[model samples]
Target: MYCNQPPEKPGNKKELLEKITNMARANSLWVTAYGTGCGAIELRPLHTSRFDMERFGIAMRPTPRQADVLIISGYLATKTLKRVIRVYEQMQDPKYIVALGSCTINGGMYFDSYNTLNVLDKYLPVDVYVMGCMPRPEAIIDGFSLLMQKIKDGRAQGWKHYKENLDYYRENQKKIITDWDLPDYNW
Candidate 1:
């Protein structure tokens, strides 16, 4: 059942196929980079020659529909959280979330701010969390690698959990996003 283990044969053919598919999906992660605050600047170096995230099969997608990963790269305001939730929902199933910077973890400097939410997991399930006010590109790359491993291990099931607990997530999102302008279902 371990991710690094080779797929078993015969009776476990279906399971073996699933494991192979997961490995392929994990290796080819198309990211939707949504930078909501100051940490957005750090992502710039990822595309440059120095970091070059593309080398790891991590490329940026123009739309959420085409992306397999959603990188929430900074502080999330109430207004922005609404949009973030919408975008996250729009992405296909088996998606992963990478929460970068201290802001998304515990609100960072905005911990006491009225418009910001301290913990991201309360509304959206986060698969990987890269700590620091603004994590370096190396840390971001590491986070992505960790996420890939999680996907391979079948531990990155946040999307499936969200679908099964839609009402609970919606209530938490609605509590902070008072305006509630979006429809009941994002799809």
Candidate 2:
């Protein structure tokens, strides 16, 4: 969707153009750098000047509420998996979750581990899956570029669908963890 502006006055073309540009920039697309596992370490280069993800108009956001994309970097333990759901819930509409590593895709090295969840999709809907034990910086950049294209084409699902599946997601989350499951250390 194009950026909307209030009615333009006779003398405000320059200001209007500036506003439109900024609005387009703001709405173009934004991603939240949600690094849940070891693959997160590789995100460093993607954000650096060398790879320079910003040049493609993909800016990293600090909070999920304002973000349009959430990058789940690597493995998800029961503990961290629960938090990922919470963060995903907080994000605004039109959000996408990209699973970064094979771990996130299918548990990678933790395929048989009890603490790790085998597949992120079992808990959340993943839009893009990048396959690698620890994907190189270029792969992350490539994934971001592909995701941006999908966003521009209006192919990405908005958060409303996620909201609709809230109960389903909650049920899946229940398979992971709860405060009652924690061990008591009191003496």
The candidate scoring highest on TM-score is: 1
TM-score of each: 0.90, 0.77
**Segments of candidate 2 deviating more than 4 angstroms:** 1-27, 180-187
lDDT by residue for model 2 over 60-166, one digit each (tens)?
88998788778888998888976787777677655788888999877899999989888887688787888898999899877866666665554555344445565
Instruction: Predict model 1's lDDT versus the native.
Output: 0.85
> Best candidate per lDDT, number?
1
Q: What range of 10 consecutive residues in model 2 has the weakest lDDT sum?
A: 1-10
- Steric clash count of candidate 1: 0
Instruction: Give lDDT: candidate 2, residue 183.
Output: 22
Clashing pairs in 2: 94-159
